[model samples]
Target: MRAAWAIYKRELVGTFCSPLAYAVMVSFLLFNGVVFYFFMDLVASNPSLSGTRGPLQLFFGSTILSVLTLMIFCPATTMRAFAEEWRSRTAETLLTAPVTDLQVVLAKFMGSMTLYAALWVPTLLYALVVRRYGAVDWGALSAAYAGVMLVGGAFVSIGLLASSLAASQVTAFVTSFGVIGGAMFALGLGRYVFTEESQLRFFSYVNLWEHMEHFAVGMMDSRQVVYYGSVVVLALSLTVRALAARREA
Candidate 1:
């Protein structure tokens, strides 16, 4: 536990100290700001279109742009975790230390998730801005944020697994981007392609689009909680195994 905590702190500090982290943070904020501006303008011009949905609800996961942003940026956020360590020969030293593979994987994962969460803190101001215009649904906003974090945790775990398997950050990013993007697209299409009731039900249960829409409206489904938790656990387990295999090799 002490080793994991120490490694986690080291990873957090090292990541924050890097120029690339700041670069990504600024780029993410800039992109989200532009999207929020357009969203606000659209809502202001067509108030009726907003209907029952709050500004934050429509802003969180109702648009293709938001989905695309996550597809691109989540991979970017985690690409350097294990891949950078390996590329710089730091992984060798780290792996030789008095730490279990699970601890190492968990430490890196927590560090990456912390950074990912920090990226979203500034976006909360959007909620404050929305509050000035009208009544904000605090419950729905909280649910939307929870959905974002759950989705982010799954994406981070996938990216971490990719990083563990790759020797360089570029490979890690590309692999994770493809997996996350492809899964989102494929699962989304399942709702339309599957005709049977059971099949459609299954697809809808796993669909990220449906999950986000529900979360945006403050409908917290237990199935979604389970699905995202499963993904994180599965991905982290694979990462630990990958690390052990590399150590043995």
Candidate 2:
């Protein structure tokens, strides 16, 4: 635990020190600000467009853009986890340390998760701003944030897995982006093509769009929890295996 904590601190500090991390943070805020502005414009043009949904819900995952934000920045933030270590030939030193593979993976994962959470912190003001003008459903807002965290966790794990497979940060970013973006596109397409209840159910099971919608409405389905939990576990497990194989090689 002590070793893991040390690695975790190093990882977090390293990320904060990187200029790319700040670039990502700024870009994320800019993109989200534009998205929210667009939503407000939409509601202004057509008051009925939002209906019962609040800004938080629409901002979270009700739109494709919101999901795209996750698909893009999550990879951007995690691209360097292992890829940079390998690129600079520092991975060998880390791997050869006294830390076990599991501890290293967990520590790095937590570090990435912490950074991911930081990226979302500034957005909380969006909620507060909304509360001042109108009624905000705190329960749904909390659920929406929870859902975003789950999605971020899953994406971070996938990004780490991609980093493990790639030797450079750019390659890691592209790999993670393609895998996550492709899956999201494919699942969304499947949702439309499969109109049958059973088929739609299957798509919905893995559809991030549906997951966010459920959360945005305060419908905390246990199935949604299980789905994302499985994704996080599976991706991280594969990441651990990938690191082990790399070590052996």
Candidate 3:
């Protein structure tokens, strides 16, 4: 347990101390600020389009832009976990440490997630800014952030899983991006492939679009909780297994 915490702190410090972290932060804020301006402008130009009275609902996780942002940023964030170590032939050294594979995996995962959460922390300012201009739905805003974090969990775990498998950071990012994008495409394909209502409902249950929409409206579905939680566990478990396998190799 102590070894795990030590590994976690080491991973956390490695991630935060890197220049990549700052670059990702600046890029995320810059892109998101532009998206915010675009939405606010659209809403302002057509008053009726301001359905929720603020941009938080749309900006948090509702739009494809939000999805794309994650697709782009998360891979870069998690790619170096094991991939870089492997690339530099340090993975053997890392894995041979006293900590168990499970601890190492969890440590790297939590480190990536910490940075993921940091990227969203700035968006709280969006809520503050919205409050100054109009009545902000703080509950809904809170729910939106919660939903986004869960969504981040799903993707960040996937990224780390990919990182564990690949030999280099760039390859890890591509692997992570491809798998995540393919899964999303397959889910979207369900609309046309499954004609039955029950099948449709099942696919929708796993759909990121509806997941964010529900959260944006302050609707917390238990099914989504289970879905996201299950994905997180599955991905992280796979990561641990990958680390164990690598240790043996």
Candidate 4:
């Protein structure tokens, strides 16, 4: 546990020291601001939507922005998780250390999640500003934030798994995006193609959008929680296994 914390601190400090983190933070805030402003403009032109100023709109708007933000930044953030260690010949050092493979992977995962949460702080300011001028549903907003964090965890896990498989940073980034993009597309297509009466609802349950909808509407669904939790476990478990294999090799 101590060793894991050491790795976590190292990763966190390393991430903050790099210009990449700053670039990602700026890009996220700018993209979110532009999207939110556009949404506000659209609402202004259509008064009916304007009156709907609760957390639901804010959440839905933020979810779209978060997806885009994660898609762009997660790869960059995770690309170095294993690929750089391999490139620098540091993997052997970490692998031969007293830490277990699980600890190493978990440390990296937690570090990435910490960075992601930091990136999300500025969005809270935007939410507060919206609340000052418009009606806000605090309960719904809280739930939505929880959902966003949950989805972010899942994405980070997927990215880490990709990083484990990749031989290079670029490969890790592309592979992470490919996996995430495919899952997202499959989830959307499943909703349209699957019959309402079919048992495919079980399969669609894996979709981040489906799980997130419950929280966006202020409902805390245990099923959705389990789904997201399963995703985290599955991805992390695979990551541990991948690292173990690398160590043995």
Q: Top model by lDDT, which number?
A: 1
Clashing pairs in 3: none
Estimate the TM-score for candidate 2: 0.95
Write one digit per residue (lDDT tens) for candidate 3, span 1-249: 888788789888888888989999999999999998887676668778677646777786567887788777888789999898888887778777777788888888888989999998998887787677666888988888888888888889999999999988889999999977788535855765788999888888777776777788788878888988888899999998887787678
- After the best TM-score superposition of candidate 2, give how far the Cα of residue 124 lies from its true spot, in angstroms: 0.7
Q: Residue 196 lDDT in model 4?
A: 69
| Candidate 1 residue-wise lDDT, 35-154, digit = tens | 999888888998896788766777786777767777778888899999998889898899899899999999999999899998999999999999999888899889988988998899
Better of 2 and 4 by lDDT: 2
Misplaced by over 4 Å in model 2 are none
* Pairs of residues at least 3 apart in sequence or in different chains that clash in candidate 4: none
lDDT of 1 at 82: 94
Give the candidate order by descending TM-score: 1, 2, 3, 4
Error of 2 at 142 (Å): 0.5
TM-score of each: 0.97, 0.95, 0.94, 0.91
> lDDT-based ranking, best first?
1, 2, 3, 4
Error of 2 at 72 (Å): 0.2
lDDT of 1: 0.88
Q: What is the lDDT of residue 110 in candidate 4?
A: 92
Q: State residue 202's C-alpha deviation in candidate 4, in Å.
A: 2.4
